[model samples]
Target: MEVETNNNNSYLSVVRRSSRRTSFPTLQGLYVSLFEGEITSDGLDLSISNKNTGKEFNPKLLKITFFLSIFISTVLCLDHGFVSCNLEYIEKSFGVGYAQSSFIGSMVYMGFLIGCLLTGLFLPVLKSKVLLIGSLIFVVFSGIYSSKSLTLTEIYASRFFSGFFQAFSIVYLPLWVEKFSPQSSTTTWLAYQQLFSMVGVFFGYLLGGILTCFTAEDINIYYMSSSEKLSSLFISWRGPFIIQSALIIPIILILIFIPGEILDVGDQEQLSEIEYSKTTGLLVSGVDLRRSTNNNLLPDENNLNKRNSKLRRSSVLLIPSQSNNPNSSKSLEIREICSNPIFMFSTFAVCGVYCFTTCTLFWLNQYFVEVIKVDRITSVFSVACIYLSGPTLGVYIGGITGDLINDYHPNGFGFILTLCTIFSFIGFITSMVVAQTHPYISFFWGMIIILFFLTSTLPMSLIVIMKSVSSKTRQLASAIAQFSFNFVGFLLSPVIIGIIMDIIEYFPFGALKRRYNPIEVGIKIMLYISLPTFFFYSLATLCSYFNCLISPKITQKKIIIANQIDIPKQLFIK
Candidate 1:
């Protein structure tokens, strides 16, 4: 009897041991699942082992690194603004026709587009720091070379190299900002980045204008040969480039101090997927349960069990089936943007705005001197006012307004953009009318008000574009938008405006001559062209409205989410 009892106890103990082992495996699986989800919030804690080993990165340090990167990148954008202001002087020195002079600006933009293409393709292989440092070196060298150049072609070549290098730095800066920012802060970071860019433009115009004030007066000291004129021109042009070249040293130093990893396309894709999943879960959770219940009656327990089994099997298959190759997904995104009507419309609208704005800004100093009857000093100061006040105030106001509208309504950007278009139209008309009729003081103030409103539209347009597209495409889109502006300003504006001036000069009415005020011709041309621009912008407003309506649905379909562990293998694993 005692032997039989002891055997029974051993059998029960063995059964209990088996049950505990089985439960342990289940609990271990649950812990692993929870760990994967939890670690996703902290990118630095990617490795489970590293979580306990490394010192925590302070958030403030990250923020500083991001802001400094933006500031450095933005400093290069000043090149365009400064060069644009100096075009007349440059033309005088090179003895180039207006059409040829336009190439000086256009070649830079051509280089910018090529640089963007190169960076987009090669950034994954090269580090951001290396690209930035290389770009800065190029800019510095280009500046020094430009100061020594006598020929139009030589200057163009220098500007092209400078622009090409600057483009890489500019494109990568925003990309890096996006990479380092918390997911929810993308727009905010973008806004601030753009703000710094505008600030750069403001300072560029101011400094360029100030430097021009001290330009060696063109004393008619005729020398024996053409070489003398060329030599003097070199000395005059050298100053601006020298100043610009000196500015790059501080920017390089600032960039060297920033700490962060360069973003690869694969990493961005993974992040995009993670964000998409979270959004997808929210959408799934929002389904109306009552409506679902009304559509189907309850089944018997066995049938329900069978249905659940089928659902589990289908979900398992679907999840893996839905998994996309990161490269393929990026390609699809690019294709979608190209095919998308909203993107097309937005691109067109941006192109138009850039063309008009750049023309206005580029010729503003000329307009002030000829039409407004301001002294060179006063005109330069006025140009400075427009550049500094308009963009600086505009960005601050636009950013605040965008944040408010985004918080309260889904279609806010559309409305804001429409408002901006309307403001631009009104401002353009007011400036034209004021120039024609108002007292000098009144006209000046009116022009200032008009410019402020017109400039305000710039940030609104930028924010609208940023909000309309996926984050993955935002940098590329911004680059394209900027490229359109540069292309129009450099290649199209000078030629088109020059043609208008030429026609006015030889008009059948015999109203103007070669000695007629070029500045007056410029202002009149601006007024006339603005009428058509106003109409185009109004059409853009309508397009933006339609885009806002469909954007949510389109965005919903493209979003995806996945665990961080899945992200590494899917995105970064070779």
Candidate 2:
């Protein structure tokens, strides 16, 4: 069971662990073993080698497997986009009004919020892979059950469970990808994770659009009751669940055969050095005291008392390791991050940005169909195209540009993000102004270009927050930051937008209804008024981020110096 590494070279040597272990451990056995008290306090150790190799999987296989897993798991991400695109059809099929149908969206978000909290609780104990696999199973079951739903209550329950389970995939997939990826390529891999999730969203839009074409045209189902719609064979509202299930099953099968982690043989020297330092007690993980003996810092090694006390104070922070009482240290770190103004401003900025994105995702299709007077097919295609082309491209552009700027100026990333948000704010206003007269043009200008600008702020703000915190707290900080944004964006935006739309549409005004249809007027007014609030709020948050960056008390000089002094890569999070 001993792991072997060559002293002469950096490569890890293979040690065949077994011959009868023909396949990787089953998900059930993995969880059962942990539940029976085999768990490690340091956290889940899923790096157990592929059953056959004893060494890490081939690099190419590892990359393929990781990307494929992300793609498959994100099939659950299709829920919102699919629902948004087909909301009208679903409402009609269920014989529900706008206010009543909003509950379905609310249920999904509620489940998602609850799921995230529960997943976060178990994240440090269970293998993320097991949570991911278990969540996918429940998601598939929910999707199938949803497809066969007979009543509004049944569909709500199905959607809630689906959202609940999908939360595991959402919160864990990025962390899992980061764990397996090499340090150098971590950002790129995370970016791809975001990209693939958007790709899933596009598929959701496309799926709903395509299936909606199969609606039985002979019968006017819009006027029919819920029971009448249910009797029909071609109810398009159920199609997304069935199609998503078909797409996800094969991916889950493939992932079970793939290994859980990729061993980074390149970090062998660093790993050995840390182990040696731990035993000698001369160096902490982030401190460079181990190198002091080789350099002029400790010239008189025999007379250890001659060593400078100031040097020790400057180099090491002496924090408790995870093997010790992790709870105390984690609590302390959480308090530290939460109290820091930089973390707060940047987190809120990201939250606002995400809330804006979610609003568009849930309402843009309805806006186009109802207010802009666009055809259903064109509206769906336009929304899909915007997602397909906007957010991913925006993230790449922002990430690369922000990296270059941060290299030259410590706060340059925030500066640039602020400017982008201002531009996005302007774009949002202009789009709403022009949407009525030039609807198609607004789709291109408002949805695509504005998103391109606004979405870039996401990665920029994330990097700022990541850099602001200490390395020991990076993982927790990142989790908490994401949870904050998702809570506002996913759990709140849609229902609020729907409520506003209903309030405007259903207001008592006999004269106004006679002059212009109340429903159309309400939707048009809601489209014009409701969506801009998030973008404007996001702009305000970015301003706060910029202010925090330039404040007198805030400084990154020490962190930058640490980076410049060749601190090991393990001490930094991108």
Candidate 3:
């Protein structure tokens, strides 16, 4: 058996070299990736044998997690609290009104959109570590500079620059994690990566509130009411930005410690060992046939051939060669993405949900203070606590479910996504109503419920996008999809909400100052967008369940290549 195994390896190595002659250039080269086991606690062997039953502390995974945590937290938190918690402070400092502040608020997003698009454009040439470090430096310095801005123009320029650079880190984060993640842990780790950013956003808000509460000075620079002077309400808005910027220095150190280029990530998974037999025909599962190439194995196969033959039975699907086939590179072809129904429908769903989500988050703190009649500090802290708790639970549950679905066809995800969308819509409406009706006492609970239901699906949506495309194009696909959803949906949502609020002002009771009801009405109206979002997701569910996401044949026969080991090329053709 050992002799046969060595023979198989030699034969497969030849096939691999030959295949490379025909592999696509889009992937740059034929890098055969394998999945490796994670390190376990007790300094145990990193193997599949133990199955990690003891819940070992994996040092490698821990290191990766810690690195991502710092990376994401530092990048995301750059502007997290700036627009959300301190817009009023910005307004006061610049002596600007709502319109100017809102435009200022949008500058960061604009920069992010530009950055996301840029990532996809230059992905082929971009080195992950260099790009990330450069972006982090840009954002960190920009953030610190923004803290010292004396005018609205300075703030605008600084925020845009910070957001633009932050985009590189954000765009690259998932791709790198996806690259390094073992198959067993990929889905969950992706969720955790997202979890890190989500946590950072909440922490930014919390940190801002804390700094505000503790750092408010007796000398009031901006005009302040007695309550404002005491409540950390009027001053010290710059403290959070400075602290977050300073904290980023440590993250850069962590980044520097991570070895290798960004794109050089892959996992190694063990397959069932191959053994040759002369009596019985070669057994097949997902094993590569080249592993059974030994001539010395039992003189003849039991059934396959009375006379020994070089070819062995293959089960695992074969990947196309990189340069040999013109169509191989088309696997990541842009036209394929645009023409696919599953991608289009799923993208629509993502855009809708992201729109509503971004809009709601932008206004949540203000809603609590102005409409719910909660104290500003309580509003910030309460929202922070809810975020800290709800998102972690939601994202993990969603991620776990996503991993489990690999057992089913890619279309199987549609059903889960559909259910998630429905739950999100219903939960959002209920939460909105509850917040409006109960205002203070029960609003927190309702929000917690809402976030759990809505956010639980967030990770799945991402998983859906990742699963929809080939591994080679995953980063580009993700960057494009995110850009489309965020740029279109997020950009519109805030503008739409603002318009609704402005129109409400025309009524005898429009502004919050005049009547709190407009804010409530506007929020409720915005929530209605979920209807169409659910509609599209439901359509996606149906499309996927029916196995309907196949792309058009560019006269190129498309076959479903899975994340598996090498197999005979003839066996995989459609």
The candidate scoring highest on TM-score is: 3
Alpha-carbon runs more than 4 Å astray in model 2: 1-57, 216-235, 263-330, 402-439, 509-574
Best by lDDT: 3
Q: What local lDDT score does residue 397 receive in model 2, on the 0 to 100 scale? A: 75
User: Mind giving the per-residue lDDT tens digits that candidate 3 earns over 76-194?
Assistant: 75456546666565656666654556667667777888888888756555566677777888877887787666567787898788778877777776666554455445567778876
Regions more than 4 Å wrong, model 1: 1-57, 182-188, 217-235, 262-266, 270-332, 410-412, 435-439, 489-491, 502-517, 528-537, 544-574
Q: For each candidate, what is the lDDT? A: 0.53, 0.55, 0.55
Model 2 residue 352 distance off true place after TM-score fit, in angstroms: 2.5
Off by over 4 Å in 3: 1-62, 69-71, 214-235, 261-332, 407-412, 428-436, 506-518, 548-574
**Which whole-number lDDT from 0 to 100 does residue 181 have in model 2?**
57
TM-score of each: 0.69, 0.69, 0.70
| Winner by TM-score between candidate 3 and candidate 2 | 3
Could you report the Cα RMSD, in angstroms, for every candidate shown? 13.5, 12.3, 10.0
